[model samples]
Each structure stands twice: as structure tokens, then as C-alpha cells.
Target: MSSSDIFIGETIGTAILILLGGGVCAAVTLKASKARGAGWLAIALGWGFAVMTAVYISAPLSGAHLNPAVTVGLAIKDGDWSNVPVYFAGEFLGAMIGAALVWVAYYGQFRAHLTDEDVVGDLSARAADTKAVEAREKGAGPVLGVFSTGPEIRNPAQNLATEIVGTFVLIIAVLTQGLNDAGNGLGVLGGLITALVVVSIGLSLGGPTGYAINPARDLGPRIVHALLPLPNKGGSDWTYAWVPVVGPLIGGALAAGVYNLAFA
Candidate 1:
């Protein structure tokens, strides 16, 4: 594939991936949405479907490496780093676009959810407590979860470890079983299988740190959340942002090492 094809395909595919993935979070979390309170199972299934759809849509052009971790792992596995920067650029740009679209699509819900009297009151109450204040400094705000992941408990070491392990599993699966015969994109069946693996990771390993196995997935939306003018939306929790980005890259590299040593 040409560089233009790689960039365009990845941009479109990653946008769609984040649009649907973040859409589910908005639907389940926002107060006025019909799917409010649908719970975690719904999110896992939604993301799985999102991955399947994005992979099939973009695989032909750019190999459907929507996640940065996937791109990094493939680069390491093939010992080719030529197209890595292009993929990263497309993934992050597409992710930001997708997140902005989600906000537009759910504008009314976001307004209602953020400006609700009860929610505002709760935030104010929490602000007064010293510990809660500290947590807010290092953790996400009320609506951040709709755009990005956060931890149930605020232990950096454990959170980092969880993200690393989750991403390791995802990249290893892609290296072993998710690639097409062309060795660039996912095959017809590989897309479905990869989607199932995503669901499995979400269900089994998503409890802590919300399983941010993709660096672009977390950071791009988080940046959007920080920039968008949502009323009463608190801090972006910049302090915790590094964990997701660094952990996934580490996990992808480690998975590539294992693949080279054992599978290659």
C-alpha cells in the first residue's frame, strides 16, 4: 500500500473505531441517553462490534491496524519501521476526530449529564474533601470515562501493570491469529476472531484501569475531552495519562519480543 493509502485507511478506520467505541460509553454513562445504565457487558460487546467493523472496513487499504499497539507490534515483528510514524499520525488524528464526533452526536445528552443539578452538587461536595481533591488531581473527572479510561483504585503501579498485560494479550493475539495471508491486514475470519479477543480482554481484564490496551484510543479522546468546552467538566487528569500511553507501547514491544523468540 502507498503512504497515502495507509494514512487515509488508518484515519478512517480508527475514526470509526473510536466513534462506536466511545459512543457506547456515552450511551451507557450519560444520564439522558436511552442506554443509560446498560452496564459493562454492553460496553464490551459494543467495542467488540466496533473493532470488527473498523477492521473489515479499513483492512483492505491500510491493514486495519487501528490501535497503535497493533502497529508497533507488527513493526517489531516484521523488523520494519518505515511506515510506523504514518500509522501513528493517522491513528491519533482519527481518534481525535472520532471523539469530537461523539461529542457532537451526544451534545444534548452531554449537556444534560454535565449540567444536571445532582451531578453538579456531587462534584461540589467532593471538592471540599481533601482526599477527594487529591484524587481528582491524579484521577479523571465525572465524564472523562466516556472519552477515556480511569482506574477504580488509584495505584499507579497496578494500573500500569494492568494496561501492559491487557495490551500484551491483544498484540500477541494479533501476531499469532489475527493477520491475513498478505501479512498486512486482518483476513475475513481474522477480523471476527480479533473482535472476540477484544471482548474477552474487556470482560476478563477490563475491571482495573478500564483496560486501555491502545495508546491512541486513550490519549486522543482524553485530549479532546480536555479541549472541548463541556460545562462543569472537571480536570482531564493529566497526571494519569502517561500510564496508558507508556504501558501499551511497552506491552506491544514485549509481545513482539515474545513472538520473535517463540513464534517467528
Candidate 2:
């Protein structure tokens, strides 16, 4: 693929990936939506489908490396760093666009959910409670989960470890089983198989930190969440942001090392 092809492919692919993946979260979490309370299974399956759809759509152009971690892993595996920055730029830009689109698509539900006294809890009362204020600043608020991942229990080490482990599993599978014969992108059936692997990872390892497993997937939307003008949207949890980005990069690099040692 040419530079333009790689950039365009990744941008469009990551946008669709986040649009559908985050759309599922918005559907299940927001009030006044028919799919509200559809539960985690819905989210996992939705993301799997998102991956499959984006892969097929972008594979021919840019090999559909929609996640920064996947880009890094492939770079390390192939010992080619020439295109990493372009991939990263496209992934992040696409993620932000996708997240903004989700906000637009679910604007009413977001307003309804965020403004509900039952959900956000009397803002004055929450303000009076210092702990609540602190928690909201340092952790995720009610609707941040729609755009980003956060740990149920706030332990940085544990959270980072979970992301690393989940991403390790994902990258290893992509390297070993998801790539096409040319080693550029997913094969005809690889997208489906990789999507299933994502679902399995979500079902099994997603309990903690929501299995980010992809740096661009988490950070880009988190940035959008911070920048957007959503009502009563709380802090972006800047304190925990590094865990998802750093953990997935580490995991991808580790998977590359293992693949080079055992599978090369």
C-alpha cells in the first residue's frame, strides 16, 4: 500500500471500528435507548462485529491495522518502522471522529442520562461529599464508560496487568493466526476468526479495565470524551489513562518478542 492508501485505510477503518464499538456501549448504557441494559454480551458481540466489518472494508488498502498496538506489533514483527507514525495518526484521528459521531447519534440519550437526578445524583449533594468529588475526578464518571474503559476496582498495577494480558492474547492470535499469507493484513476468514477471539477475550478477560487491549481504541475516545461538551460529563480520569496506552503497547511488544523467539 502507498502512504496515502495506508493513511486513508486506517483512518476509515478505525473510525468504523470505534463507531460501532462505542455505539454498542452508548446503546446499552444510555437512558431512553431501546437497547439500554442490553448487557455485556451485547457489547462484546457488537465489538466483534465492528472488528470484522472494519477489517474487511479496509484490508485491501492498508491491511486494516486499526489499532495502534496492532500497528506496533506488526512493525516489530516485520522490523519495519517506516509507516508506524502514519498508522498512529490515522488511528487516533479516526477514533476521535467515531466517538464524536456516537455522541451525535445518541445525543438525546446522553442528555437524558446525564441530567437524570437518579443517575448523576443531586449535583449539589455530590459536591458536598468530598469523597464523591474526589472519586469523580480521579476515576470514571457515569457516562465516561461509553467512550473509554475504566477499572471496576481502582488498582493501577492490577488494571495495567489485565490490559497487558488481554492485549498479549490478542496480538499473539493476530500474529499467529489472523494475518494473511502476505503478512500484511487479515486473510479472507481471518477477520471473522479474529473477531471471535476478541469476543472470547472480552467474555473472559474483560472484567477488569474492560480489556482495552488497544491503545488507540482507548486513548482516542477518552480524549474525545474530555473534549466534548456532554452535560455533567465528569473527569476523563487522566490518572488512569496511561495504563491503557502503556499496557497495550507493552503487551504488543512482548507478544512480538515471544513470536520472534518461539514462532519465527
- Model 1 agreement with the true structure over 1-264: per-residue lDDT tens digits: 999999999999999999999999999999989999999999999999999999999999999999889999999999899999999999999999999999999999999988887775677687679887776545677799989998899999999999999999999998998678778668888899999999999999999888889999999999999999998787788988999999999999999999999999
lDDT of 2 at 257: 91
State residue 72's C-alpha deviation in candidate 2, in Å: 1.1
| Candidate 2 local lDDT, 193-263, one digit each (tens) | 98999999999999888988988899999999999888778889888999999999999999999999999
The per-prediction CA RMSD against the true structure, in angstroms, equals 2.1, 1.4
Superposed model 1: Cα runs more than 4 Å off: 122-139
Model 2 stretches astray by more than 4 angstroms: 127-135
> Ten-residue segment with the worst summed lDDT in candidate 1?
132-141
User: Considering every candidate listed, which one attains the maximal TM-score?
Assistant: 2
lDDT of all the models against the reference?
Answer: 0.92, 0.91
